[model samples]
Target: MSHPDPWRTATLGNGYAASVCVTPDGDTVLWLLAHGGCIEVDDDYGCCCTDCAPHEQLNRPIPHTMRSALDRPIQPRCSRPRSDGQPCRTPVARDGLACHWHRTTKETAR
Candidate 1:
């Protein structure tokens, strides 16, 4: 079976639209604005923007406004711990919790 796409597109009203996707780091979501810039939102709902105007307007609570688009499941990241002892940020392989490199190491350990 095919996995559901993680990207979502939403209309932001006033003729503006955005394509939203989770960042590879898995800690932030990126909003690619129609106006040729982007915004990055963290789990705490804090945001940074490439354009000041849109940032001023769309900087409010994002979950309420983009509920439908943000409701989809987030892609799972690799579970292996890194040197800093944090979980790896890489996306997991289709059938496993570890990313490619970590998955190989796991298999070799068996």
Candidate 2:
């Protein structure tokens, strides 16, 4: 007999079937069926398992607006100007509104 793949969908003791996989840290994650045939991942968030991995697992559906926000283009240009008096075209910091050089210079000046 051929062994079944652990990631394959299996009967979960109901009409529901889900694919379960173990993460690198050994957390049992289940891709369960939600409403309207949408698949949702169950990372045992409601369970009392103490050894559950700290990494976030998708268990809820994200709104279309929020999902689109992730796909929105990031045009992070530096706020400072160049030596010719034109606006800087360098990319800004991911964590802040300023670019790397401007942020460091401002910090050192304080």
Candidate 3:
């Protein structure tokens, strides 16, 4: 199953929202403005600016990071049924459909 994206656009106290995330190394921060702008900054003044692009033309990758924050998937709820026959309210395993208990039982039976 596919999971939601960890990085999300947040409203900056106004009608505007932007996707923000930090690099895995925690040295750089990147954000894409919903108003056709992009911002990137590092510790020093090496990279810092708010570049305004045309509508839907903000296609640029964050630099100096091993993995893109957008590539990481968000946590997903389990699809199993609970004791009351309701959907499970817990998150699923990282690489499996069910949660730890459900997946473990099914795997052990095999």
Q: Write the per-residue lDDT of candidate 3 for residues 21-100, one digit (tens) a residue.
A: 55445443444344433343333322233343222223554542324555677777775666687866677555347776
Displacement of the residue 26 alpha carbon in candidate 2, Å: 75
The estimated TM-scores of all candidates read 0.34, 0.25, 0.25
Count the clashes in each prediction.
Answer: 0, 0, 0
Query: Would you list the clashing residue pairs of candidate 2?
Result: none
Error of 3 at 110 (Å): 17
Q: Which tens-of-lDDT digit does each residue in 1-110 have in candidate 1?
A: 01112456676775545555554455444443445444333344433453433334544654454565688777777767776877677875443466776766744221
lDDT of each: 0.51, 0.51, 0.47
Q: What lDDT does model 3 reach?
A: 0.47
How high is the lDDT of residue 23 in model 3?
48
- Lowest lDDT block of 10, candidate 3: 46-55
Give the clashing residue pairs of candidate 3, or none: none
